[model samples]
Structure formats: structure tokens, C-alpha cells
Target: MSKPPATILASVKQTASVIFLHGLGDVGASWLEAFNTYRIPKAVPHVKFIFPNAPIQRVTLNMGMPMPTWFDIHGLDQNAKEDQPGIEKSSKYLSDLIEEEIKGGISPERIMVGGFSMGGAVAIHAALTSPHTLGGVLALSTWLPLSTTFPKALISGDKKVNLPILQCHGDQDSMVQVQWARLTEQGIKAMGFKQYTFKEYRNMEHSSCNEEMEDVSKFIVQNLPKVD
Candidate 1:
């Protein structure tokens, strides 16, 4: 029997309001450093950060090595499109976790979801597809997933969700390519979707930079559910 692909590591802090999804081949625990430094103590100080691990699965590209992945990489070989099953399944798992958080007293308006790499892509999908609007969605070095629409198209009749999204990508990213990010932003805007902010870093690779994290921290602080 195969193990489930996703697991949520709730923070010791009961007041956590932020959740993080780690990328392919990485575990959720790996992001603790950034969350503690950039996201936790500074931005959403009282917010608890939930780090959810993607499921371990046989990746088509990595010689079928079972690694943490939200979706298959086969489509990545075909111009970075996403596989529907993997994307949808992963989004459901993440959404379920978010709902549990809500039950624990964190309102949708007070919760923020973000991720890195494939995890970032999953974050984007979950945020848009979720029934409730969120405080914000932070996508780092990621792209839109399969079966997704932008601002207005994503909203149904009276289903308006004015979600502020933050997109950051590395200009020197060889894996995902900077152009993908640019094209995604353009496509969303062209479709009449707004309320998104994008930042592109020069000479950066597939990983997050301190400056980028710093900028993200500030954005969270400024946009998060304000305290009384």
C-alpha cells in the first residue's frame, strides 16, 4: 500500500494564521527557517504557520523516484502544463486542511496560504479554487495550475473573491523559466483580472532569495488581517 502524499504539520503556536506548502522533493519542515524568520515573528506574528508536505509519488522525470510532489512532471516536459488529477487531488487535500484550520478559529479572511516551487503552484490552485476567499496567496517561483482562471473568470455569479495575490519568480530560473511567470501575469491581466502584485528577481535561480522573502514578509504584514 502506498502512503498518502500530503501531511500537515501544525505549528506549536495555536494562533497560527499562515500555511506553507513545500515544493517537489522537499519536506514541509524545511521551510521552518523562513517561516520563523520572515513570515512568523515579523509579518504575522501571532499567526500560526501550517507546513503541509506534498505526497510522495513516482515522478516521471526523476527516474520514477518517489518524492514529494503535488502533481506529475510529465506535463512539464510538454511546456509546463499541469496534470489534472494530481493538481485537483492535491488541492482538495490542502483545502481540507484549511477548512480544519477555519474550524479552529482562523477565519478565511485571516488565513494566508503560500508555497515554494511545485508547492507554490499548488498554493495558487487551492487559493483560487477554495470556496472561501483568503487574506492573500503567496506564490513563489510558481505558475498557474491546470483548470484555473483569473480574477473575473475564476469568480462565479455573486462569487466574487477579491483575493490579493503575490507572484515572485527568479529571472535566472532555468527550471520554470522567467517567461512562464511573465506570460501568466499577462494572461491574467489580459483576462481583466487585477489585484495581483508581481516581483521578478535578476540572476536568481530556482530558489528563494533573502530579498524576495523580505519583500514577501512586508506584503504579509501590510495585507494580513489587521489586529484590533
Candidate 2:
């Protein structure tokens, strides 16, 4: 029997515009509460949301415990990388999910891709390198992975597209170093990314904050392509 395709949880309305990928271990359902509590109320009339779960893998931080992850952690003492087959598969899976969303009446320009932690890295990588330029990208406490094509994408310029990205990280985040976030922001800006937003919340840990989420809402409303 063929394996079942990964499921993505969506909001009540077909207003699906933004697609969210969750961090390691946490399921897509974990995002629903945040969406309902924060993003839904400020919902732009036609903007819908999608949360896709990463496949299961062995996480280094969790004592090599096998859980849902976009890529393998490899070793506890090492950093995150996208060199493994699982990582590539997960990336392609995310790409396919975006394609599916497009076929369901959501234009690439109308779709925003985002996530927390590891999910954030995946979203950022996929959005930056994808053939189609997404509407916007929200990466919360996420960093740029090592195996990205940012250099080529940089030299290519924003010819085919220019996307606005919203990235947030915590100064007190122990999981992903705060400096990495800064590096990601600096690198993207240097690469001719004129429309990117970065936020570093003081004293916050490795999770989302009300203010950051609020900024996300504003950014989403602001950057969405104006429909005629």
C-alpha cells in the first residue's frame, strides 16, 4: 500500500492564503490555538491559513528521540543542516503542499509561507529558492539553513519576483542562537531583499509573543497583493 500523504490542517474559510509549517516535535494542531487566539480575529476577509506537519525523525535535542521533524538533527552537539535525504524529501513535500494550495484557488502571490523554529528554516529556504515568488514569508525564531542557494538567488536579482519576508526571533532564545537570526537578516538584506521585516523581542524565550504575533498580523495585511 502506498503511504498516505501528509495532512494539512486549514481554517474554517476557504480564505486560505498563508501556509504554516510547525517546528520539530510539535504537531500542526499546536498552531491552531495560536491562529484562533491571535491571527483569526484580525483575519483579513479572504486570507485563509494552512498548517502542515513535518515527518517523523530522530531529534538530537530530545535525546535522539524520534519525532516529527523537517530534517534530522544528526547529533545533539551539531547545528541544523538540510543535507540529509529526509530534509530534501520534507522540502519537496512542502513544495508540493504549496502547489496543492495554488491549485485550490490560492495564487502564489496570495500565499504566505511561515513556521516556528525548524519549520521557520524550512519555510524560509523553500520560499527563497522556489521557482515562484511567494506573497510573503513569516519565519518565527527561524534561521537560514546551510545548504541554501541564497548566493545564486542573490545574483539573479528580484527579476522574476520580489517577496516581503517577516522574521521574528527572541533575544533569550537558547535553542537557536539570537546571533544567527541577525546573520540571516543581514544576509538577506545584502542579497537585494528590499522588502523584509525582522523583529527581535527582548527577554522572550523560544516561543511567540503577543507583540510579535501582532506585528505578523500587520505585516500580513500590509504585504498581501491587492486583489482587483
Candidate 3:
């Protein structure tokens, strides 16, 4: 079993949940700390927060240096070889987290899954493949992996195909370049996904900015509001 995720319990009656995943070489604690630094928790005290860590493994992009990675990356190129199996494995873990929430009494519709960069890539995959329809998907500084296999690999009749997706990226990101995000935008459009929002930050790099964080907080609230 994986390590228990860092969590923030809701202040009021819990009705919704958000799971935020970190990027390569990151741990759930760091992400949770950063999240606490913001007003996200206060913004929605009724929403439970979860930060899960990816497993540590060798990364080819970093010359095989071991790091906490959701999946292996052969390279950063848009067309580089992707670790499909690894991605699927990580996606299952995320889905299992969602299952945990559902089993704990939170409805599937009240749950949101999200992540940054590589983690965001897996979020997109897992959200698209889940048998249940979630509240939304939050993908930051990331591109769609296995882009070609999409729409086909996506579940045939799952409501996740129409799942709300908020994809944010830095226009000046040299790592997961803005071009890659644009391609993902085009792909999402081709797939006819409803409720998809793509936000590009000006003068931003691979990292996030205050404006992006503000948008993220709003997205969470918008997707997972208080239930009656």
C-alpha cells in the first residue's frame, strides 16, 4: 500500500472533496504546506483536501536519477516515448483514492481530482477513464499524455468524457511548452468535451503564478459547492 496522503479535514459538514497531486520529485507534505499557505481551505471549509505522493523511481529525462514520479518520461519532447503502463498504474491509485472518498460517504459527483505537471497528466488520464463521473479535473502546467490513444482509450459510455476540465499552463513554459497545451486544447475540442476551460498565463514559466492560484481556488469552489 502507498503512504497515506496528507489531508485537511473540512471545518463544517463535509460535502465535497478535492485531491491535489504534486509534480515530479515532490511529496504530499510540500504540496499540502503550499496549499495551506493559500486561502483555499478557508475559501471552502466544507471541502475536504487530500494530497497524495507519487512513488519514487528512476526518471530517464533526468539521466535515470531517481525521483518521486507518477510515471517515467523518456524525454520532454511532445512526441517522446511515454510510459503508458506506469501512467495506468498511477491512474488506478488515483481512482482508488476516489473510491475511498465514495466509500466514506462522499458522492462521486462531489469529488475532484487534480495535479501539477506530470501529476496533472495522470489526473487527466484517470479522470477520463474513471467509471464514475467526478465533480471536475484540475490540471496545471501539464499536457495530455497518450494524446493519440485518447477518445479511443476513453470509456465508451462513461460520463467522464464530458467531465469538466480546467487546464492551466504558462505561456512561456520551456519545459512543457505552451504549444503542448495548445495541442491538448485542440484535442479536447476534437473530442467534444463539454465544460473545458484552458487558461494561459502571460510571462509565466513552468511554475504557477498568483493569478493561476486564484483561478484554481475559484475552479474548486465552482465545481464542488456546498450540498443541500
Candidate 4:
């Protein structure tokens, strides 16, 4: 099924892009509003922001309920069964989006993919499995989706192993807990992606805070600086 186009915040002199994904049950515009709240768009006027909407799908975790989800989540625990096909489908979609940006003249090194929770999981998968090297990936309060398949996935996919990564989590995150982020941090390192940083926010739950957004802004500009 064809979903709506992303909520775009095009730059006047666009040279770089940050294709960010929102959390489950969230529209791109909602995170677009969050970016506005944090002045992320203002922080980097040269960077075009593309927030794509996830297709509605059934989530087993939610009792077979359908919502705007990139993939179906079986459960919240780390050992829970993963929907590989669903995740890979979204990964391909995201990689295609990145390819489109590259075809439009933005270099691979000038593009980033990011998301929250489930979307963050997709971002990590799509970015790592992509054949091209990219600017970076912002994985917020999310874990590595198919952890058991890593290194193997990395080997067979002919993936890009080198790129900066920023992973942030909340110590008080009730939805996606802090331990999962820790495991993901270790998982990312074990997979040979060394340029990753894990930041923890105090007193923050399963949501964004001003400090976290500020860090995100810094990451975007630092990786995709003004080229104009």
C-alpha cells in the first residue's frame, strides 16, 4: 500500500538531508513539530529534513492491532521474536529514500537516517545494511532489532561499517528500557562499528527532552555541516 509522502522541511540551499522516522503510532508531522520545538530546522538551514510516515500494519504486541508502524513488534523483551521481513522491508524503503537523495545530488556522506523506538530500530538496520557509507545515524531510545543476526547480517549484506552513531536513552524509560540501550551499545561495538556514542538522559521517560534535542541538533550540524 502506498502511504502519504513525507512531511518535508526543505532548505533554501539544500545540500544535506536528515531523513528521520517517528515512533510507532506517530505521524511524521508530529516529530516535525518536535524538531520545530527544538529549533532543529533552524539549527541547520542548509539541511533538508524528510520525515516519512510509516505504513499502517498489525503489531502482534498490540494484540494484532494495526497502526503506523514500520514493522510488527512481537514483544518488548530482548529475546522476543522479531519480524525480519517487516523490518527488512522498511529498511529497503529507507535505503531507497537515501538513494533518491543521492541521485538528487546529495552525496552519501551528507545524508543521515534516524528515528525513535521502532523507527530507530529500522534506521539502525537500514543504515548499517546499506551498501553506501553515510553521514551518520541517530538512534534514540531504541535497540538493535535483529541482534541475533548481526555480524552475519553485516557480512552477507555487504554493509557499510564505518559511520558515526549517536544513541540516546532515558534511565527512566518505561517503554524501551535503559538496559536494552546498553545491550545495543555493546552489540553495535561487537559488530565493528566503532564510531558510536551512547548518551543517557536523567529523569527522562519514553519521550524527548530539551537536552536530548540539543544534542541531536549538534549531531546533525557536526556531521552535515553547512556547505554553503
Best by TM-score: 3
TM-score of model 1 vs. true structure: 0.86
Q: Which prediction has more favorable lDDT, 2 or 3?
A: 3
Candidate 2 on 63-148: residue-level lDDT in tens?
88888888877542235444456555666677787898889877787788888988888887778767777788898998877535
lDDT of each: 0.74, 0.74, 0.89, 0.87
Evaluate residue 174 in candidate 3 and report its C-alpha lDDT on the 0 to 100 scale: 91
Residues 94-208 of candidate 3 have per-residue lDDT tens digits of 9999999999999988999999999899888888888888899999999888888888878743465568899999989998989999999998877888789999999999888
Model 2 residue 52 distance off true place after TM-score fit, in angstroms: 0.8
Which has the higher lDDT value, candidate number 2 or candidate number 4?
4
Error of 3 at 175 (Å): 0.9
**Candidate no. 3 TM-score:** 0.96
Candidate 3: where are CA atoms >4 Å away?
156-158
Deviation of model 1 at 204, angstroms:
0.6
Would you list the clashing residue pairs of candidate 3? none
| Candidate 1 runs further than 4 Å off | 1-16, 75-81, 147-161
Clashing pairs in 1: 5-55, 15-48, 16-47, 16-48, 17-47, 17-48
For each of the candidates, give the backbone clash count: 6, 3, 0, 0
Candidate 3, RMSD to the unseen true structure: 1.3
CA RMSD (A), model 1: 3.4
